[model samples]
Target chain A: MTVYEFAKGLILEAGGQVRSRMDESIQVETKSNPNDLVTNIDREVENYIYNSILDTYPDHQVIGEEGHGHELTQLEGFSWVIDPIDGTLNFVHQADNFAISIGIYKDNESYAGFVYDVISDTLYHAKKGEGAYINRQRIKTVEQTTLKTSIIGINPNWLTRSKSEAIFKQIVADARSARAYGSAALEIVNVATGKLAAYMTPRLSPWDYAGAAIILEEVNGVVTDLLGNPLSLIKPSSVIAANPQIHEEILTHYLSHHNEDISAFHQYLNSK
Target chain B: MTVYEFAKGLILEAGGQVRSRMDESIQVETKSNPNDLVTNIDREVENYIYNSILDTYPDHQVIGEEGHGHELTQLEGFSWVIDPIDGTLNFVHQADNFAISIGIYKDNESYAGFVYDVISDTLYHAKKGEGAYINRQRIKTVEQTTLKTSIIGINPNWLTRSKSEAIFKQIVADARSARAYGSAALEIVNVATGKLAAYMTPRLSPWDYAGAAIILEEVNGVVTDLLGNPLSLIKPSSVIAANPQIHEEILTHYLSHHNEDISAFHQYLNSK
Candidate 1:
């Protein structure tokens, strides 16, 4: 099978494993800190994907959030980076909001990515040079919807910490709506699905943005640093990914309010 | 059937009706302001409950968010106050987070209530002096949990406006986690399910808190004004509802930061 086919098969299989496990009471463990968590379901799901992929493609490398997989230096050749459950805290609390995210890289470049919001049964997938897909139908980033007409997904952390609040307040003032779903991976899926016109976050880790980055870009959406530059897949950065029109408008009007912070945000991106 | 069963059945049936209609495109109209919205599905759902109940109990009074039902006064005899879509913003944006909530009262006292989060398939139900249930299984309110070990659901507005960010900051400084789901109805449901230790919000109307109020109380949780007095079914107020111990700690420490606002809030509640 082609890598995409193998990836999709594994994702669906892992998703089913996840679905069945939700009803079973499983022990939850704190990861990194109390705010972050991982359950046996996460490891079980990740192991299923890892074993399936390794048996199918032994040469391919892997990185998974559960620490059940490798720690990679370079993203050379075929490498699969997985986050078995992307909103783990939400999953621990609500048994929702968590996503099974997988991104495939060939020769250090993203080839395909899949993010399945398992509970909602929505799968957002994309292959580079082709297009994005939500379920089966091919999808693209929505057209240049104006800021005032846009509904954006944001993380509440930025509302207080990052100087982005001015931009955020302006975005809220300009957009149809503003929301924070607490999951970067899922938010990117929403952006790709056209359910969200744009998504911005001041800081995200490489693990948080990798899967969704491939999907968002494949759909013709722009994913860039706060200063309006493309995101580096190998590293995390402050980002504004949106419909082309609003992305630029947001970059122009919203970024100007915090020109100093904008420059500093860019500097932080570069340092990362 | 008892009033509680009647209310639960109607609420679930109304929810199913709303969910079935969700796939079909419908005209959405702005309500109150652009930030708020109402769809034909909302009115249809509320109307279904209203007509179905009136058919059996013609003398019963009904109040609904859509304004399609009666303007309840004095709450004499049986009354059903409902919010067809508790989180219209979520419904409009995410097609989820919206819930069907119905609050039943007998002789000016809340008797039965149900809040069904259609998408999540979570049904939080309660009956006066009986208890609360989740998916028909009894669920008691969470026992006394320290703020340091608790998770809280807060309204974003309060974080930005509440004069004392102490409780907010303290909770962040102390709690296991903090979140804001943007739906008062769902937040209360979270408390009933023990997913959250407490829910605090300022400026809520009767329609928003009615169903949740009944559910939280049934679970052995306490719902009170910021001053630790019982919340009124009639007046809108700033609320801090939690497991008893946490509720007292939150009120004494966190809520006291805004002493000046308390009296004004009291006045507002009394005036309403």
Candidate 2:
């Protein structure tokens, strides 16, 4: 089987396990803060993916959110980044709106990506040159949309506490509407499918966005850091994913004015 | 058939029509503001529901968001309140998060309620004394949860523009997480199903919350205006729906401190 097919199989299998075991009681622990949650299922899923990768491609290196995989300082040959459960708090609380994400890279370039929405039975996947698909249907490029007529996904907390709160608050006011689904992977795919014009956050780990970024890119959507820079494969950074027009509009009209505050915020995140 | 059964049938039929017609090109128009939207499908669904109700119960009065029904000064006799498409913007854009909502009232008392998530094919329904159900399974009463550990659903725009922005912002910070699904009926049912501990908004029309209120109450949840006042069946009002403990806590600890501001906001809404 091709590497892309194998990755898809692994994600589907992991998603199946999550769907079946969700009814049983789960053990949850706090990570960075009380609200930052992780569950036993997350660790188990990560372990299964990691072991499966090693058994198939013994030389492949894996990095996952639950620490069951290698911690690489840099992307090397045949590297995989995975998030076992992208929205752990949603998984533990709502029992839905979470996904298992897998991104395969050769050296530093994206090769394939998969994001499986466990509850909904929807799988979003893409190969480097091939286009994106939801389940079996190929997704079309996001239609051109304006900021005033588009729905955007953003965490409400950013408006209340982030250094760029003023700028974000203005965007929220100007947009058609705003939603916070609490899953970066799903939100990115939402943009890919034209369900949202844009999805942005001030800080997200690579595993949180890695897999879905490939899917979004396949649909002609743009993914970049808040400062309009290419995302770093190894570091947590602010992210904004949108169709070309809306992306350019936000970066040029709104985010450009808050460069210093955004820079300081990025510095604070990196220091932490 | 009982009134509850008839209402459910009407909702399901309307939802089915919505699901089938979703792929067709639609005509959208702005309502109170540019962001406040309505569509031809919304009008079509409302007309279908109103005619269906009148055909079955000739004496029943109807009030709906799309204005196919009566505008009573006070709800009298067998009155039906409905929002044919609850999240019009979601219906227009995402085509997924929106729902069809219907509430049957005997004078001012809630008799039955239904909120049908068209895309997911999930139906949330309840009779006044009967417990709530999603599709076929009966839902349990919301578990006891502290505000610090609970997720909430709220419009982010409220944080930017409402009179109680400070209080709402503080509550958002204290919660586990916050989401905005852009549908009041679904958000209220999110509380009913224990997916959200609470959902609050500064202003909403009667059609928005009418149906979901009964479902929530049947699950031992609380529904009240922002000032802890009983919601009017004939007018727009601020709304807060939550499980009992969180509802009481939010009112006593957070909202109580800002009565004048909230009251003034209510007055402003009333004047408008």
Root-mean-square deviation of each candidate, in angstroms?
3.5, 1.1
When summed lDDT is taken over every stretch of 10 residues in candidate 1 chain B, the lowest stretch is B157-166
List, residue by residue over B1-272, the lDDT tens digit for candidate 1: 98777777778787787777778997789866676788888888888888999999999888887774444446778988888888887787668777888888898887887889998788988888888888879986577787876767764334444453433545544666566676788888787777778887666667787898898888788887777777665666777778888888887876777666676766866685
Question: Native-vs-model 1 lDDT?
Answer: 0.76
Per-residue lDDT of B217 in model 1: 88
CAPRI-wise, candidate 1 is: acceptable
Reference-based TM-score of each model: 0.86, 0.98
How does residue B272 of candidate 2 score in lDDT?
A: 83
> Which consecutive 10 residues in model 2 chain B have the weakest lDDT in total?
B158-167
